[model samples]
Target: MKSTVEQLSPTRVKLNVEVPFEELSGDFDRAYQALAQQIRVPGFRPGKAPAKIIEARVGRQAILEQVVNDALPAKYSQALAESETNAISQPEIEVGDLVYGEPLTFSAVVDIRPEITLPDFATVSVEVDPIEISEADVEDQLEELRQRFGTLTAVERGVAEGDFVTLDLSATVDGEPVEDAATEGLSHEVGNGELIEGLDEAVTGLKAGETATFTTTLVAGEHADSEAEVTVTVQSVKVRELPEVDDEFAQLASEFDTADELREDLRRQVSDSKKYEQAGAIRDAVLESLLESVEFPLPEKVVEDEVEATQHQLVHALGHDDEQINRFLEAQGKTREEWDAEAKDEAEKSVRTQLLLDAVADEAETEVGQDELTQQIIMQAQRYGMPPQEFIQQLQNANQIGALYADVRRNKALAGVIGEVTVKDTNGDVIDTATFFGGNDDAEAEAEGDDA
Candidate 1:
């Protein structure tokens, strides 16, 4: 058996393999065994017929066909291993005619990972928004806390902004009632704008027991993307009455003993939240800088697969309903062609980023520990509102655990570069990335050892 590789392009390769007749004994044995089970012969039980007898009964041509079919996959894999090709996509295999007592020849064309020239990390620079906590930010937090402890008082006036209302809703399209669009005893905030379009405006200025009718386009259900007349009846309107920000109110609402102390704590909380946002912004800016500095050929097949996967997810959510998909596109003001083009562009960017990070991980010799992988899994489980154990089980069932491992590695690789690059805030202050990236793991481990 022998194999050689041909560089078809920067991102693709072709492998030519030849397996002599002597190397195919295993393939022949398996094929004969399979054929023996399917063919009946005189004076022999099922699967008991000799290879020669079975071949004679089925004809040499049939035996050879079975052997070729059974041999291709293993031969292709062996060729890949021997040639050390980094295939990123499935191969398109072509087999030549089999001559008796001659070596079997075949060729496979596949997309390969492209060589990338990584930029110097120390030269990369980015700027992010500075973390600034304002008086208004603290006051906003205080207001939210007060609202949580506020009481809802029954109001004898019309619905107004900041008022909570309990209502009943129903809708009809062309005088035909939309069954799924009717609900009773629904609670809504007047200015929230979370429900149907024009709901807030139509319900405002309407007192209890008054009904207002407005038109809206249905986004889901039987008449999706169609205009429907919606009627909302205000059952009751109530306003929230918040307590004054005094020492007594502070004691009642929080653990703090004074209103000033409570306000100070709220200010600290706001600062911490802003710091988190700034960290995220810095990470994004750094990644953008890296992407702008690097250039490499992307595998077209990989990008196509990503786009197809995105489409599959949407189709699965809609239960394979193309009409619902079209309605969704209409609601977003996008044509099918435009949406497809956008998907392709997004896929290209995504693939490029993954390849870049993968190369970085390779160059850095990044390793993911058990604890880091577990932490990532727990974080993902929390985001999806599932138990960690259940999420792990699902990942194992879907065989996505490896993909998750790669994702974590890629993330760590990107984070590892943060300490080497220069990051500054918009206020011209140098940013300390160690505060967010957790610093070098080796240094931390050394410190722990010293403490021990």
Candidate 2:
């Protein structure tokens, strides 16, 4: 067999291959023999029919077509290997030059991985808003904990935020009950907007057992496009009763003797969480910088595929219909054309970042130790609200163990990259990495603004 590869673009190519008759002769003979065994001619036992006889019965072209159909994949694959071509998806095939005692010729158009010089990742630096933990942050978190442990007591009072209210609700579309819509004795906090829009406003002033009705279009969610007439009846009113912030409350809530100690501990937890978030943000910034530094022609199909996946994930996140999602996408400044144009770039960036991180991992000899991997799996299981061994069993059952392993390995690689990069705060000041660095940018900003 002889092969030639023609580059149509950075990510695509056309492979031309021809197999000589001598190579195809064996495949054709086997096909003819299979046909001979399947059909017996008069005066001959099964499988004893001559090749000429089979060809005469089935026609030469028919046998050749069958042989080519069976053998083309192997021939193309061999051609790809010999020519060092990597195809991403199935090839578009075309046939040519069909004749006796000659080469079998065909061409395949395929998508290929893009070839480019990787960007200099070592020099990439990113500035992050400082990971700062403050007294107010600790206090705010303590407040949340107090609220969680607080008691909800029945109240003959008006509706207010942070108060849970039990209500019965019903909705209709076009004066008819929506296909599967009704609610009874639903408990919702006044500020939680999980129920249909305007339900809280309509039910707000209602006394116990009092009812009110209103109409509104659902926000962009699973039922965004529809409008419903909702009637909400207040079944009960209740107010949360939080225990006083004191040493006794601290002892009951956690391993602390004083409220001050509990607040300090919660501050540490929030700070650690903030550090994790900041690390992620910094990684993203470095990756974006690295990607921007590189210049290469991207593969169109790869980009299109990535863009499609991104769009699908977005729609899945919205949990909405395609029309509503398109509107949301439009709001994000993404048109069909722009999405298509940007798809390849995004895919290339993702691949490049992974490759760069892997290189760093190699240089640092980073590995997810067995103990760490096991602990990671356990943590993931806890996140899923499942037992560790059961989660591992489920992963193995679903053939996702390899994926889990990959995730652990990739995280180790990213950690190596993070270690090498010097991160600065948004103000160009070096961050005090040793300090108990925890801060919420939004809340901190609000506090700073208040002081101003």
Candidate 3:
């Protein structure tokens, strides 16, 4: 057996392989065994017929066809391994010749990972927003806490912003009632804008038992993208009565005994949250800088597949309705052509980023330990609202464990580069990334144990 590779392009290769007849004996035996189990013979039991007898019964052409079909995958894999090509897509194979006692020849064309010239990480620099927690920020958090402890009191006046209302909602398209669009005694908050569009404006200034009708476009169901007249009738209105922000309230809301202590704790929490936001912004900036400095050709098929997948998800989310898709694009202030172009651009960027990070991971020799992988799995499970074991099983069923491993390696690779890059805040101060992303061995060991 022998193989040779031809470079078709920077991101693609063609392989030519030839296997002598003597090398295919194992394949031939397997093929014969498979056929013997299905074909009946006068003197032989099931799966007991000799190869020569099965071949004689099935004819040489049939036997050869089975052998070729059974052998292609293994042969292709061998050729790929020998050629050292990192194929990123399925190969297009063509058999050239197959004759008894002669060499079997075939050729395969596949997409390969492109060679990338990485930029120097030391030269990369990015500016991020300064971490600042103002008094207003702490106050906002305190207000949210207060709202959580607030009591709802029934009000007799017309509905107002921040007031909760019980209402009946019904909609009609072209004067025909939409069954799924009708509901009775639904609770909604005025000015929340969480329900149908124009609902807040329609319900405002309406007292109990008063109805207001307005026209808005339906976003889902069979009538999606169609204009509908929605009627909202308010049954009752109630306002939230927040507890006073004093030392007594502080004790009830938190472990702190005084309002001043509670405010200080909230400020610290806000500062910690801002640090995380700053770190994220820095990471994005660094990646963007790296991408802008590097130039490489992407595998066209990979980009196309990514773009197709993105479009498929978008369409599926829109319920596979073309009209709804158009309406969504319009609502987003984009045309169909513009949206397509953006999707392709984004897909290309995504592919490039993955390839770049993978190369970085290889260069940095990033290792993803079992503990790290488990942590990633747990985090992803939480994001998807699935149990850890269930998520792990689903990943195994889908054969995505390798993907997760690669993701962890790529993340570690990026983290490894953060030390080499310069990061500054908007106030012209050199930010200390170590404050947020510093590696703590003890913490990691504890986390690993917890995960285990």
Which candidate comes out best when scored by TM-score? 3
Tens digits of per-residue lDDT, candidate 3, 316-360, equal: 987898877887888899998999899999999999999999988
The runs of at least 3 residues in candidate 3 whose Cα sits more than 4 Å from the true structure, single-residue gaps closed, are 318-320, 439-452
lDDT of each: 0.91, 0.76, 0.90
Candidate 1 vs. true structure, TM-score: 0.89
Q: Which ten residues in a row have the lowest lDDT in candidate 1?
A: 436-445
Backbone clashes in candidate 1 total 0
Write the number of the candidate with greater lDDT, choosing between 2 and 3.
3
* Positional deviation of residue 322's Cα in model 2 after best superposition, in angstroms: 7.1
Which residue ranges in model 2 land beyond 4 Å of their true spot? 24-60, 97-101, 218-228, 309-420, 427-452
Better of 1 and 3 by lDDT: 1
Backbone collisions counted per model: 0, 5, 0
Indicate the TM-score of model 2. 0.73
Which residue pairs collide, candidate 1?
Answer: none
Model 2 C-alpha lDDT per residue in residues 334-436, reported as the tens digit of each score: 9867865676567767655544554455555666778978999989999999999999999899899876775777666565445545668987886543232
Q: Number of the top candidate by lDDT?
A: 1
Q: How displaced is residue 182 in candidate 1, in Å?
A: 2.1
The 10-residue segment of model 3 with minimum total lDDT is 434-443
